[model samples]
Target: MEVSRIRYWLGVLLVFLAAFCFALKGVLIKLAYQYQIDALSLLTLRLLFALPFYIGIAVYQRKREPVAPLTLREWLWLFFLGITGYYLASYFNFIGLVYISASLERILLFTYPTFVLMMNAVSRKRGISRLQWGALALTYLGILIAFAPHIQFGNQHNVLLGAFWVILSGLVYAVYLVGSDSMIARVGSQRFTCYALIAATIPVFIHYLIRNGFALLNYPAPVYGLTTIMAVFVTVVPTFMIAEGIKRIGSANASLVASIGPVFTIVLASGLLGEKITALQLLGTAFVLAGVSLIGWKGKKM
Candidate 1:
């Protein structure tokens, strides 16, 4: 019993760490750009470099626990989930990072819970209860509060684009989550993440060819270092951990726990980027939290 308890707590900790690393995605990417690597270049660097690590893990896992046949339909859906969620979403996010503060991007990316709810609606789930209703309301409100300070000062064009991309990214993530959840039932969580990364990388490489010819990829010492860290720490490790977390905990609980992601980003920005949390952002974050809280709190009621 104690062993199970310890494993559960360890999983929770790893998931939280995954969310924190993801929040740093923008920060590290922007820092890479300081040396002149563009979004296309950043994506290329991260995906290409991270590919070996992903493949290695996937290969190792497959050796231990062979995967059963996934029907043609499941394979198709997995491709869609990976391409849209990982490749397209990450590209959009990196583009947004070029224009916004990491803190703001983090706040926006955390909006995935709203999409998850909407996705559930698409499936005709039982129903959302009163507590969930209240939690959703607060979570959105918290999101608004958390980043109110930084949004106003940015260029209007950049701000609009930033909001657009980050929100889209969140939607893609929701789709990926729902799609991959089914796949996880067939394969173990670790295997799913391994396959997920490889599946996502297909379009990612294609994107590099059509959009960029690699001019943007050449980087100096600083950009190379930061992008490597971003790929390994932010992209590979944390992402795999989060996928496993989603499988261990239901998406509702996982999303709520993940909702706390922005708190770490805002606090980190204050120290490293010297960005201050604003009254409005704090309020938004509170709303987002409230909404997420309602989801779980409401779960207990029934």
Candidate 2:
């Protein structure tokens, strides 16, 4: 029991660390945008820097433990998850960040658990519980409260457009989350993460080639430096940490711990990017955190 308790807490810590790293993603991307890089180009650079590490890890894992070959269905699922999870979801997020505050971006993205709950209820052919209904109400109400201030007073030229993209990212990410659990169980977390990330990387490279070609490599030195940091610290490290954390403590618990992300991002954005935090934003964040925590708690209960 003691060993299990230690393992659980370790998983919680890993997830907390992963959330902090993820929170840095928005600030870094916002900083990169200062150099006038397009979303695709920036995302491409991030994956380009991250690709080698994932490949090296996959190779090392193979050498360390010769796993069975994956079935065609598994390969297909990996491709699907790769496209939706990292590629589309991240692309939308990057684009959205161009038009919204980093704090708002994180707040909107943090609503994915609501989408996940809805998706699960649909798939299971069951109605949502009363607790879930209340949670959903609080979550969306928080988004509305948080968003209203931005629309009225924020300087962003296209807050609605940005919110749309980020919300879409959250929706697609929910799909990825729903699909990934079974795959993770089947393939093992490390190998599944490596394969899924590699699968995501191919399309990013191809998109960059088709859209901007070699022009993306000519960014200012700081742009590359920022992206490299993003790749290593934000992308690679957190990806593995969350995967391993989920393996140890299950996704529900990991996600509950990760609820710290939006608040962390708000703080980081304020300090790093000069984004302001308002009373309304804080209240909305509280609502979102409460709703998400309730969902995770109820999920674990069920």
Candidate 3:
């Protein structure tokens, strides 16, 4: 019993850390924009820095686990998941951030859990649980609450456009999550993540090469520094930590903890990027947190 309790708390800590690290991605991307880096270039740099780690992990896993070679079909599925989830989703979010405040982007992106739940229900051929439905409602309600004040004040067209991009990002990421479920089961999570990330880097490289050939070496030191931090601290570390958290506490609890990401991003954006935070936004954050908590609690009970 004591060991089980310890494992649970450890899982909670890992999830919290993962969420905190992931939250930094939005704020860091916003900061990178201050250097006049375009979304594509910034994204390329992030992937470039991240690629090495994924490659190393793949090599290590090859030696350590000695799994069977992935079939062409499995490889193709992983490639699809990687491109859709990490590459396209990231690309959309980064581009959207160019027009939207980090806070808005984070809030919009936080809707993925709802998408995930819906996808699970549809895939499993069952109606969503009432608690899950309620959680989704509360989560969206919170986002709308936070978003309402911004809609009233911001440039309407730009805000709407940015919202669309971020929403699309969330949708694509949901697809990735759904697709990844089976892949992660077939190959272990760590192995699947490493392989998928390596595959995702291909498009990023191609995009960057076509856009700005050999210009990667020309960035200022700060761009390199920021991208490195974004890649390592936010991308690599949090990806594996969240994976481990799922292994321990299960995906439901891990996702609930991750819901805190919006709040973290909002606070950081307010301080670092000078984004405004109103009472409505705080209330919205609370609603999102509560809704996610409900989902996690309900999942645990089940």
Candidate 4:
């Protein structure tokens, strides 16, 4: 029992660490954009660079257990998941960040749970309990507080557009989460991620050919270097860690721990990147944390 408890804490800590590492990707991409990397281009570099690692993990896992191979339909869905959720989602998010602050983007992105909840209610009538709803309310309140200072009053049209992209990212991301789990049950997690990422690369390459006329090789070393780091640290390492964490602790405990992502993002943005943090932002973060808590609380209740 003591060992299990220790392992659980260790897993939670690692997952939180993974969230922080993942949060840094936005700041890095923001830096890359300053050097003229377009949205698709950045995503291209990110996905392509990480492709091998994802596949490697899958192959390794496949060796350990004779896992079931993906069926044609599952492959098709995984392909779509990779393209829409991984490539398209990242593409829009990068572009949106160019128009909005990381602080605001994170706030909007964190609204995904609300979408997930709505989807659940629609798909099945098992709506959230009252306490869970209150927690969600607090969570969003915290998110709002965190972004209080970045809120501009006039000509907020671009903010509106950013919100749209962020919401789309959330929606598709929810689909990927829901759909991917279904796939996981079908063909195991490692193989599912590996094949899906490889499958998704097809659209990314096509996007590059159309957008940049196939001169993807002309960029400086830093572009490739940063892209590779984004793939490894941002994509491979953290993903593996998250999967491990979630495996050690089931989804219920894992969801609550994962909610630490936004809070990590805010602190990293403020302290490391020197983004401003206001009193309202702190309060809002508290609220958002509350919502995340509710979701996990609900998950555990069952």
Better of 1 and 2 by lDDT: 2
- Residues 205-302 of candidate 4: C-alpha lDDT, one tens digit per residue: 89899989877788777888888888888888887788788888877777787777766777777765677766776677667767876877776775
Candidates in order have lDDT scores of 0.74, 0.91, 0.86, 0.75
Candidate 3: tens digits of C-alpha lDDT, residues 1-302? 99988998898899899888988888898888888889999998999899999999988988998877889998998999999987999999998998888888888887777787788778889687877888989989998998898788764358888888999999999899888978888889998988888888899889889988889888778899999999999999998998888888887778777778888888888988887788998998899888877876776776
Q: State the RMSD for candidate 2.
A: 1.3
Residue 74 in model 2: lDDT: 83
| Winning model by lDDT | 2
Taking all chains together, each candidate's TM-score versus the true structure is 0.88, 0.96, 0.95, 0.91
lDDT of 2 by residue, 78-145 (tens): 99998889899999999999999999999999789999999999998879999999999998888888
User: How would you encode candidate 1's per-residue C-alpha lDDT over 94-192 as one tens digit per residue?
Assistant: 888777777778878877766777677568665765555666666666655554454656433467777788888888887787667677778877777
Off by over 4 Å in 4: 146-148, 153-157
Off by over 4 Å in 1: 146-157, 243-253, 296-302
Backbone collision tally, model 4? 13
Worst 10 residues of 3 by lDDT: 149-158
